[model samples]
Target chain A: MMQALVTCRGLTKVFGKGELAVHALDGVDLDIHRGDFATLAGPSGSGKTTLLNMIGALDKPTSGEVTIEGTPLSTMSKAALSELRLEKIGFIFQAYNLIPVLSALENVEFVLQLQHVGAAERRERATAALHEVGLAGMESRRPSAMSGGQQQRIAVARALVSRPSIVLADEPTANLDSTTTAELMELMSRLNRDNGITFVIGTHDPRVMAHSQRHIEMIDGKIESDTND
Target chain B: MNNFGILRTIAWRNLWRNPKRTLITLIVVTVGLWSILAFSMLLNAWAESSRQNALGLLIGQGQIHAAGYMDDPNIDHLMPPPDGALRDVLDSDGVAHWVARLQLPGVVQSEYKTLPITILGVDPAGEREISLVPDKIVEGRYLNGLDDDAVIIGANLAKRLKTTLGRRIILMSTGADGYLEEYSFDIVGIFDADQGFEDSYVFTGRSLLQEYMGLDDEIAQISFVLPDESGLPAMIDTLKAAAPDLDIRDWKQVSVMAAAMNSAMKSIIYIWLGIMIIMMSIGIINTQLMAVFERTQEFGLIRAIGLKPRMVLWLVTLESALLMAVGMVLGVILAVLTYFGFQGGLDLSGFSRAMEAIGSGQVLYPQFAPADFVIYPVLIWVIGVLVALWPAYRAQKISPVEAMRHAT
Candidate 1:
C-alpha cells in the first residue's frame, strides 16, 4: 500500500449561516496516494471545486481535518501554510493566470523565486520546465503575445518548475478547444507518469474524466460515487 | 528573491508604465518648488541689498554719541571732538574710517526758494570713508578741503531751494542755546544717495558747523566704518568699552525700519511656504490615491504570490519617493538657473524711481541662503512621503481574494 500523500477525514465546508446558510460541502472522506492522477467531476454548484481548494490549502474546511504528508493544515500558521503552498503545492486555474506584464520565462520563474531559489538555479530550472512543456523558443514572449494554448502551457511550466508534491487544478481546460484540451491532458498525464507527481483536477468535462486514472463524481454538495478506471 | 529588491524593481517599472501621467505630476511638483525658490531668493536679495545701501548711505558700521544723544539728539548732548586716544582705539579695533558729525534741523534759503532740511556737519576726508558721498554726487563735486563755510546740498533739497553748486545759501537754525541763529554756507556739491530721505540732506564741514553753532570743538556723533559688515557687532562692543560715556549704535539700531521690513519679508516667505506645502500635499495625495486605485489588482496578484501587506505599502512609498526625487531635481535645476539669471544683473530701469523710493535702484538681483536650497527640497520630499501614507494604508487593507476577484 503506497502512503497517502493527502488525507481528508469527514471534510465539510459551509457558506453563510442560519437561515441563509448553504452547505457547499458535506461530510466527505478521501485519501490520495503519491503519484495518483485523479479527477473530481460534478455539475455547476457541486462541491468538487471546494474540496480541491481545501486540499490545496486555499480554503479551510468547516469540520474535518486535512493533512498533506502528515502535517495537518489546521495546525499550521498563515505564514507556514503559505510556505507549504510555495514549496510543496502548485495550482493551475481555468483562466491561465499568468502575469500579463511578465515574459513566459519570468512567469515560470516567479514560483521558483517565491520558493527562495537562487537566480541562476531558478532560471535553469524554469528554462527546463518551459522546454518540457514545449515552450522552449517562446520564453521572451508575453502572455498577450501568445495563443491560448501557449499561455496555458506557460502556466503548466510555472506549476512544474518547482517540482511540487501535488498540483491542484480547477477547470484548467474549460476555455480550450477539444484538440488543445486533448493535447494539454496528454502533456499533464505524461508529466504525472514520468515524474510521479500527484494531480487533483476538478472539472465537469467528459474528456478530463476519460483521461483521468480515477474519477470521483459529486452532486450538489456531496460525493455521489468514486470509481477507478 | 529579497522582498525589498523585488518591490523596488516593480516600483521603478510601475512609474514608467503611465509615462504621461507621471510626467505631468512631476511637472506640477517641480513648478511649485521652483516658484517658491525663485520668490524666496528674490525677496532675500532685495531685502539684503536694501539693508546694505541704507547702512552705507545713512548709517555707518556703528555710531557713537553722548549717553542720551539718540533718544533726543539735541545739540546740548554733543561731545567734544575725538582726540588721539580715540584714534588709537579706532585703529586697534580695525576701524577702516571714522567721521565726526553734527546733525541738526534747519531751514535753507536760496535765491528763489526756501525749504526745511536736516543739516549734517562732516569732515570731508573722514566722511568719504564711511559714506557714499563721493559716488553719489549727481550734479557737482563732493567736499575737497574744508573751506571755512562750504556746504553740500542734496539733489532734492537743492531743487526745492532753487540752488546749484558753488552758490551761497542762508541756513537758519537754533544754536546749542535756545536762541535762533543764522549762518551762510557756500554750496560746494549736490549729492543724490538714491534714497528720498538722503536726497533731501544738507552736508557741510564739521569746523564750519562748529563756528556757526558757537561750539568750538564739540561733536555730535562719531561714526566708524569696518571692512566687513559682519564685524560691526564686535566693533560696537569695542567702541562701547573705549568710550563709556558715549552710546554705541550699530547699523541695525540706526535703521529700525530695515529690521521691520526684514521681519515682514520673512513672514511673507513663511506664508508662501505654508501655501505651497498644502497645495503640493493635495496634489501628491491625489496622485497617490489614483495610483493605488489603478494598481489594486496588480497588488493583489503580487500579494497572492506571497508578498506581505507591508511590502505593498513599501512599494507605494518608494514610488512616491522616486517621483518626488525626480521633481526635486528638476525644480532645483530650474531655481538655480533662474537665480543666476537674475543675479547676473537684471535691469529695473522702468521701476528705478519706485526702487529708489524704497532705497533700491536700477537693478534687482536674486539670492538664496545655502540652507534654504538644501533644507527646502528635503522638506518637500518628506511632505511627499507623508502624503503617500493614506494611499499606502488603503493598499495595505486590500484583501488579496477580493482584489483578485474584482480585477481593478
Candidate 2:
C-alpha cells in the first residue's frame, strides 16, 4: 500500500542503428515505492547503469517512458529535467566526482546553492551533511587532498545535503578499499533506516546487494530476477 | 552565495588551475593592447608635429589676404593694415598672435648668381610669435626693427648666392608704380630650414620694404594664430564679417598637404587597431577553446549535478571576460608607463632630413588621449567576450552522460 515513487513501463534505450546498434536497455518494466532501498546488480553492459541514467533524468529512453511520482519524464524540457534533478533527485557517480576547484564543504553546498537556498541555511545544511558523513573537521580540504574513501564520502555529503526525494548512486564503492566500503555501506543503511529516504543503487557487488532490502539482477539489457530479502 | 557568486568563484579558481596557460594568454592580451595604444600615441604625436611644423613655418592657424592676393602676390593685390572692426576681433582673447607681412614676388642677385624668390616684409617683434624662421636663424641675428635695412636670407640661398652675414645683395620687385625697381641691402642673418623652404623665401624689415617699394602702409597678408584650433572656424567667421572684402581661410584650406596628412594618420590608426584586434582575437579564441576542451568532463559533471547548459555557457564566458579585463588593466598600466618614459619627447633628430621633408620637427612628443583609453579597452573587452562565445557554446552542449566516460 506504499506510494510508488517511480514507475518504468517497457523502457528501452538503443545506442546506435542497423547492424551496429546496441540495446543498452530493452523493455525494463519496474516499480520502486517510497522508502525502498533497492539495488540493481549486474555485470558490465547489462543495462543497470543505463537504467539508473533513465531514472535520474540524465538521459531519455528511446522507447516507452519513466515516470517519477506519476509525472512522465519524457514530457519535460531539458530545463525542466535539470530543475527536477536539482530539486527532486540526487546523484552519486562512480568516479567520486566532486568539483575539483571547490573544497569539501563548498562541494556539499553546491546543490543547495543551485536551488537558490539562503546562504545561511545552505551553509548550515552542508555542514550538517558533512558531519553526518563523518567528515566534520575536513570541510576546507579539497578533493585532490583527500583519499578515495574521503572523497566519495564528500560526494555522498553533496548528494544528501539538499534532502532530495530519491538518491541514485552508481558504483558508489567501486573505488574504495574493503574497510572503506564496509563503512560506506553501514552509513548508507543507517541513512535509509533513520531518514526514510529512498535509494536506488546500481552495482555488481554482491556485498552491496546483501545490504539492500530488494535485489534486482539484470543481464543483457533484461532483468533476470527481482526479489525481496 | 547565489548561483552567479559560486560560478564566479569557480571561474576565478579554475583560471589558475593551469597557471602556465593562463599566464601565456594574459601576456598575449597585454602585449597586444600595449602595442595598439603605443602605436596610436606615436602616430598622434607625429601628426601633431607635422601640423605645427607646417603652420609655424609661415601660416598661422589662419590667414587674411586681399581678395586676389593668394592668386597674385604682386603689389597690385595689396591691402591696408588691420584697423577698426578687423583689428578689434584680431585683438580678442581667442587670437594668440597676429602678424602682418608685406609678401611679394621679387628677384635677388648675389655677386655670383641671381634667382627669383618670395620676399616677406616682417616686423621683428611680431614675427617672433608667428614664424619659425626667426628662431631658426643659424648665423648673425634676426631683423632689429621695422626700420632695420638689413635683410635675412635662407642658408640654402646664402650658399647659392655665395653670400654670408654682412654681405650686400640686390633686391628687385615691382614697386607701387607698376615698374621694376631695385635696391641694395645687407644680409644680416641666414636661417636654416628645409631645403625647399630655404630656397624659396627672403625676409626684411616691414617698414624698410614698404618705403623701398613706394608703399606707405599697405600690407599683403595678415596671418593669425588661435589658442586652440577648434576656435579657428568661429574666428574665421568673425574676421570675414569684419573685413568682408578680404579672404579668410583656416590652415587646412591654406595647406592641402597638412589636411591630407591629418586624414591619412586617422586611417593608419584604424588599420593598426584592426590588426591588433585580429591578433588578440586569435589568441583569445585559442585559449578559450583549449580550456573548454580540457574541462569537458568537468562540464559534464556540473551539468549532471543540475546546472543548465546556459549557466555553463555563462560561466565559461565569465572566465574569459575576467581574463581579458585583467590583461587590459595591466596593458593600460604598461602603456601609461611607456608614455611617461618618453615624456621629455622622443628625439628623431637623427632622421632630421626625413622629418623635415614631411614638415615635422626633430623631436616628436607622444600624447595620451583620454578617449582612446575608453574606446580601445571597452572595444577590446567586448570583442574578446564575443570571440569567447564559441568556446562557451561548445561547453554548453556537453552531455551529462559524458561524465560517465573516462576523462583525459
Candidate 2 runs further than 4 Å off: B71-76, B105-117, B147-150, B157-186, B207-216, B227-230, B347-358
lDDT of 2 by residue, B1-408 (tens): 789999999999999999998999899899988888998898889999988888898988899999998887789999999999999999989899999999989999999999999998998999898888889999999999998898999999999999899999999999999889899999999999888889999999999999999999999999999888887889999999999999899999888888899999989989988888898889888988999888888888889889998999999999999999999999999999989998899999999989988778999999789788779989999999999999999999988886566541
Model 1: per-residue Cα lDDT over B1-408, one tens digit each = 665665666677678777887888888889978988888897787787787777777577678888888888777788887766666778764787888888877888888978777778787887777787777887767877544467877777777777788789998878967787788878877788664665457887777777788777788888778877788787787777777777888866876887787777788888998888888788778888888898777676555555556767898898888888889999999999998778676688798788787766467678767788888889988988988888988997776555654641
Model 2 RMSD vs true structure: 2.7
Q: Tell me which residue pairs clash in candidate 2.
A: none
Native-to-model Cα distance after best TM-score fit, residue A38 in candidate 1, in Å: 4.6
Model 2 DockQ class: medium
Which candidate number has the best lDDT?
2
Query: Could you give candidate 2's per-residue lDDT for residues A150-217 as a string of tens digits?
Result: 99899888888888889999998888888898888889889999998889999988778879999999
Tell me how each candidate scores on DockQ against the true complex. 0.26, 0.58
Backbone clash total for model 2 is 0
